[model samples]
Target: MQKRVKYFLIRLHYLTVNSNHERLHQDREIIYGKRGLRQYWEITTDKETISDDSTWLVMTKIPKINYKKVGKIYQIRAWVEYGFKQSKSELCWADFRVTNYAQIEKWWQLVMSAYLMVSLHSDSFNPMVTPVSEKFQQHDWWNERKGWKNILNNLRLIIKPYLSFNIISRWLKVFPIPQLSLGLPRLINLMNEFDCLRYFVYFWDNFYYSSA
Candidate 1:
């Protein structure tokens, strides 16, 4: 009973849907500016550094709370991806949760290694591209927009991917791609692209292709 209550409270705190009529302007301000893409930092939680220092460019995209029970701890990785001719350095923050901080650090190290390893090829590692605005515009329901804002507003909070298999299968019906042959590792990499969905679209298309 206690566990159930705890779970309910956590879920409520995590996914509460609030009416924005009073805060419409405020929500709009949050949705379109630096306030829209909120970022936060914490010194420690459960003996872990919950957020990176401000000296670096830090961003986190968390999933949902309910999904965490399945061992899908939300993750974020921060590292220096580019360098400039100045004393200050540039860093990128990515959200992806693992069960423990060890995995978090490992993933962060992987990206750092990738950045350094790829530096031999180019001065920058540009493996991922931000989805085009047109893609988002097509799915522009008010709630969808609100959800996007929620993601941006709590970028640092840990969350499990909010999507489900049924949700994914439905999206697959829309695309007519013949096949996607991505092996497991590439699939994981694709999932890392977005905190939610975590490459949900990519997963659907690839899975659709694989089935074909």
Candidate 2:
């Protein structure tokens, strides 16, 4: 029975991975582009509204940033504050003040829902849903199909603790992951290749923000 259970667990893991593998890759490409040249933005709130109190941005370069899509910038900021880490390089934390954690929590839910949808449907997991499919039809997490709903529910169960830990950790000043040590050449390369880096970074940001 134990062997059978283990086998079942293994198979279940693969099934989950196979089901969404392709979609992940596609999702990465969709938001980040081929080379990942997308810019990132962060926002923070002070008194009440989301404002320029404390904002940290991880970008390929400042010059390549597009200010047209300001909404996306806020979304990215929410993702970071919620505990998502950079996929590639370390980003300097910009100081910003939020009025309260309550407002950030609300934004987190919306972003989380969007992130799950794209993750399940992107090309990395052999994403096989159609536009007509019920899953692709909406961004609401509760409205997702049974399988996806299960996944999202499980994720939420996991995420809440993670978020709480993150907030506490940041406040207490702990490093969950070690900071990177790159020399001047690599730093210059990061800035010089901002176009590609921005795309990749922004793509990840979109995925991360969608979780809220």
Q: Tell me the tens digit of each residue's lDDT in model 2 across 15-92.
A: 112334421100001123332455433322222332444433334344555432333333344566554443111221
lDDT by candidate, in order shown: 0.30, 0.36
Q: Model 1 — TM-score against the truth?
A: 0.18
Superposition error at 129 for model 1 (Å): 23
lDDT (Cα, tens digit) per residue for candidate 1, span 1-212: 22211111111112112444221010001112232234322211222332433212223344322222211122222222222211012214255557788887777666555333223222122223233234333433312232322333232221122233334544556863334222433444544543333344554444321100
Compare the candidates by TM-score and give the number of the best one.
Answer: 2
In candidate 1, stretches whose alpha carbon ends up further than 4 angstroms from where it belongs are 1-91, 94-99, 123-212
Q: lDDT for model 1, please.
A: 0.30
Number of colliding residue pairs in each model: 11, 41
